[model samples]
Target: MSTQARPGWMEKPRPVTQVGKAIALVVVVALVCVPFLTILSTSLASQGEVVENGGWVLWPTEPTLDAYRDILNGGIVTHALGVSIGVTAVGTTLSLLCTVFLAYALARPNVYGSKPVLLLVLFTFLFPPGMIPSFLVVKELGLLDSYASLVLPVLVNVFNLVVLRGFFQGIPEELYEAARLDGAGDLRILWTIVLPLSKAALAVVGLFYAVAYWNSWFYASLYMESDHWPLQQVLRTYVVAGEGLTDTTTGEGTVSAPQTVQMAVLVIATVPILIVYPFLQKYFTKGVLTGAIKS
Candidate 1:
């Protein structure tokens, strides 16, 4: 075979192809940006403006942060924010610890019962517990109505564990042999060797855990009281039941249309993910690809 590139691959596209590609890109951008703009504008606009403009605004005539202030002024919405932050932080940390320990153990060679344990883990991944059984288990464990209900049942995500295990297995055996020669035990080897090299995978898995915990509301609904509901569950009520929140901006305490308050809540719930994702984006591809290739 000639060591030349294919002519078609190197050739510039015709004008028609270029135009079509540009059009497609523009359409995709508009589809995403338009809805985001409408929600943001609606949230910033006054309740009267939102109501008068049919629940969505492309641009607010006069933007105000009243809706945001209302939510952050130490009410249920504020409390829910606290609950969500706490749960995401604590849950992600615990999940990462448990997953790292388990994945490291499974990745090692000739460990007692490793195969059966790995098989059992994969079996759960394939056959997975149903909602009813999971609920019953949570209830029986006296986990209902507590924060543990949110974290414990879903901790150590099977996919994340498998990904970490695969990533760990890809480490060269020579490194392990060297660590053993230095009289470093498994814990020391893992701490000083495996973990430092697996930063990308750890970052990816931690991001996964954070996002999952932050976005979870179903479990909160099932196991928590209304007052204990996280931001998503509380926002769900606003979006689903069409309930209105009081406009704290006005001294008269007027009730705002659900759209502004609802959109504000949605934006708040969404912002943390937006902020955190960029930091981890650079690691995402390598981490996922390494695990996938190993598998």
Candidate 2:
């Protein structure tokens, strides 16, 4: 038997009717590229050129890696880079686990007091516990001057929990029924089935948590001793606050190049996020749409 052909309208992709979308895409891409190009150029440019043409460098006439070397020679920037990496790794793992458990519980129908728990979580978003109260709690827990202060208080994100819970709820009931018939318990189902299926969601949410922790400085500034501060905080002190300790660590009388070193620090702080983002981008739309549709 021969099948009949479908209508022409059903065979074509949606047309890009408006010029506005094309222009917007161009503008958005250009805006993103310009800052990165500026940072890269500034980082590569020689100290003489940087100073002679103000603090900003559009393009390097002669590139050098002296800035990277000076910073790596046991300076403030190098120490702070290690601190940032450590905190980000620890924080992301803890945050992902906590969010997953809370979200999974809430996703189940008739979970005991799940509504109230969700409300409490959402309420915090609108009316956060005052900073003073939070600080006191951290102090009472004896987390002061400790790295725990960076990770623990912000361990679970309400938004991430909601996203995961919605995605969990969207899983077809037939899958759960099939797993149950095969003698799988809730934990077993989650581990063997749900989690594997939800990899995209997890990857996207995990990346968000990782990026937040990596970029965080406010909490570190408040809770950490200045000596143990993360890269962003140290960057603020040296690059923004103009308090240099490069020579102090280098055993030299003066810094090799202040502007180049500052740009190098900025580049270092930004590079990790840039590296992580492309890997996670594919998951974002898939995960976000599923969560959004359900929630």
lDDT leader: 1
Local distance difference test, each candidate: 0.88, 0.84
Per-model tally of clashing residue pairs: 0, 0
Clashing pairs in 2: none
By summed lDDT, which 10 consecutive residues of candidate 2 come out lowest? 10-19
In the range 1-295, model 2's lDDT, one tens digit per residue, is 1126656665443345335667788899999999888878888888789889987798899999988887887766777888999999999999999899889888877578888998888898889899999999999999999999999999998778878988888789899899999999888988998889899999988998998998899998899988789999988877777775645545754344378878888899999988988988999899888777775
TM-score result, candidate 2: 0.87
Q: Candidate 1: worst 10 consecutive residues by lDDT?
A: 246-255
Number of the top TM-score candidate: 1
lDDT tens digits, residue span 1-295, model 1: 2236658667656788878888999999999888877888888999889889887888899998888887788877898999999999999999999999999999997688888999999899789889999999999999989999999999899889989999999999999999999999999999999999999999999999999999999999999997888999988876666565543433343344357777898889988988998999999999888777776
**What's the TM for model 1?**
0.92
